[model samples]
Target: MSPSLLAALLYAALTLLLLMTIAALRATLVITRQRTADAFTPAGDDVSPFSGRLCRAHANCCENLPVFGVLVVTAALSGHADITDPTALWVVAARVGQTVTHLGSGRRRAIRLRFLFMLVQIALLTTWAARLLWGAMQ
Candidate 1:
């Protein structure tokens, strides 16, 4: 598989992992035998902070995955991957960093770091697309 496609798959897999984390956390909190349906039915009643962070992280992943997927797929099919490969690598790395920072959310510095990582990934994506476009126009 092309490296850009591989990177896109990696991001998709990471998003799935985040989703599973949220699901697992919710299950642990909501599926206890001692609790009735009423107690667990409503959100924000007893969700863990970590679970909340995981939720946000998953949300963020969902928000970015579509664009990233499109860009990576286009790059993979473009046949001009000189910039795409490095951009893919950098974007994946930045995504990992963002996920880690998001998992450690709630701190000011952590939030800032997450934003920085997200910006880096966005920048890489833009660069990848621009390179592909430029190559196509040549």
Candidate 2:
């Protein structure tokens, strides 16, 4: 498979991992009879700090996945995998870095590092999209 496709799959896996973490946390609470299933807030505000960070991390993935997905799909469909293949894994790496940084701490330094990761991803993806579109127009 192309690196771009593999990156997309990895991105999806990362998202799923976050979701599973949230589910497991909630399940633990329910199973331990600490909280009812229906008592949890959607944003995880009522939960512990880690839960809140998990929710935010998952949400960040959800928010950005489609942008990455659509770009990767477009590249494949439009014969522009060449545009994305080189930096695809880098994008995934940045994505993972962003999430890891987000999950690691909520301090200002960590937040800045997370933002840098996110910026790396956005810049790479944007470059890919622009290249693909530009190539298509040729």
Question: Model 1 off-target regions past 4 Å?
Answer: 33-46
Residue 53 alpha-carbon offset, candidate 2, angstroms: 0.6
Question: Which residue segments of model 2 deviate by more than 4 Å?
Answer: none
Best by lDDT: 2
Candidate 2 on 14-105: residue-level lDDT in tens? 99999999999999999999999999998886898878899999999999999999999999998888888999999999999999998889
Clash pairs for candidate 2: none
What 10-residue stretch in candidate 1 is worst by lDDT? 36-45
Positional deviation of residue 137's Cα in model 2 after best superposition, in angstroms: 1.7
The Cα error of candidate 1 at residue 95, in Å, is: 0.8
